[model samples]
Target: MLTYCLNEYPSAHGFENGLRPQLTFICKAEGNEAAIPRVMHKHDERFELMFILAGTGIYNIDGRGYNVKRGDLLLFNAGVLHDENPHTSDDLLIFSCGVEQLKFEGLPLNYLTTRSQAAVMPSGHLYGEIRGIFEQIWQQVMSKKRYGAEIAHHLLSVLLLLCRNIWLENNPEYSSADSLLGQKIKTYIDNHYKDEIALKSITAALNMNQFYLAHVFKAWSGYSPKQYQTRRRIGEAQSLLLSTDLGVTEVANAVGYDNVNNFHRIFHNLVGIPPARYKKFWLTGHIKS
Candidate 1:
């Protein structure tokens, strides 16, 4: 299986100018597959949107499994855990483009990360248009013509605008307190997980009382606000420990734990192992029965 580590375009290189929303097209041969070396990797500044033009595959995103086939589009937020592997013998053709320069007017970045699976499957001409754009972008990238990146970025921005419009049209109806509010709260926690974020702060941000936000968030996401926050922080910590060379203390800080002892205690309670051991296991990529 092919392994890829997506990182920021190095700053020192002149490639930074070309890095803005450049399309990367992959056409794998039969018998070729790919895997993410670990659940996560170094945090990059850009997001990725991928569409499968042909063939079938299995996508693994933060332990969730998805069946990918032709016409399937997938979005990944910066720092989210994700990987894809081909499942069929047919050659796999995929179009991937950066979202750094694209402005998705009505949709929040958190929406793409939290609701990516559902958003990709939404019915309507939106999906069709996105698929068509991907096809054209793939052709442009593969042709290696002059100004290909410029053309691809423009097409990708148009597709994103269409998607944002569809999302705005459906937002009110599809966004229940549970899904919408829960997603917003989750995003907040992800950004503030390392700090002592009070429930009051969370409720205030949502313009709701603590009681209502807590109850609704739990009902929708299957975890209380604090519980979900801790879980997410720990999950991110685990990913960093396993994937990056950052030290344990740095990983602890990365996830918002200032006290090393507290970090160890929580890591053990949630992961059932110490950070180092868990990292070792993650590196092995073993599927424990």
Candidate 2:
């Protein structure tokens, strides 16, 4: 996985020039896959969209499958499980790009994130046009010429906006709140999980039965409300660890963990390592991910 960077682009989240989370610039790209692989099971933190530049495959996203061919696009929202296997004995080439972390700005956040299937963007002629834009951006990133980063940033913006338009056009009935009640619960948790969140408080706030809330929330997202909240907290914690110099206890507290020990246990449980070690993994240049 490669993480692209543009230090002089406009940021969507008040990140000044040359910062992360700009209106979602390309954080990574996988250009050519001349050497074929039959099967791939992958997941990532970023919102990933893959344009099938060539070949055909059965693409699976979050358990739902779609038969995809050249000129098709497959979307895997941040952290969604996806797999691909081609029926033909040919190389499956793809141009995959991602945003390291999601901060909704120009794109429709809820619609993109809660997608249950690998969306198919079918436009054969338009595929060539989109690929041209990608090629220009790829050259800019690779060349690193004067204003290369800024130029690439603009090109990336165009690419994403075009893609978003295509995605929305392809699915006219796409709803940001696919599951209205469940989405509301998710939004509340995403915003308030940084503080104490009681399940009963959520139920009372929503004026719904606990069992019904659990059923819907679980159905919408695989996890129950509490589980989702914890996962969100941990996800925030990971972001903080990567982006800040705060200590483990402070990071834990920042993400709503009152007990440092419990936070440590949960972080380790969800992530394979402790907080300190996780940070070290980034610091040590072990991976560009």
Q: Quick one: best TM-score, which candidate?
A: 2
Worst 10 residues of 2 by lDDT: 31-40
Model 1 pairs in collision: 194-256
lDDT of 1 by residue, 136-234 (tens): 876877788998867877786566555555544554444554666666777787677667989999878778889888877766555676866677677
Evaluate residue 24 in candidate 2 and report its C-alpha lDDT on the 0 to 100 scale: 41
Cα displacement (angstroms), candidate 1, residue 256, comes to 5.2
Query: Candidate 2, residues 1-289: lDDT per residue as tens digits?
Result: 9876886665443212333332243433232323222122334546666677777766645534467887886777665544445443345456666654334444333225336323667755687888887778767877879998777667655665666666555565434443667667876776687778888989898888988888887765557788767766776777788888899999999889999999999887766567887777767834223
- What local lDDT score does residue 86 receive in model 2, on the 0 to 100 scale? 48
Cα error, candidate 2, residue 75 (Å): 8.2
Which regions of candidate 1 are displaced past 4 Å?
1-96, 104-129, 168-170, 173-192, 195-215, 222-227, 238-245, 253-289
Runs of candidate 2 with Cα error greater than 4 angstroms are 1-25, 29-136, 146-154, 174-178, 287-289
TM-score of 2: 0.56
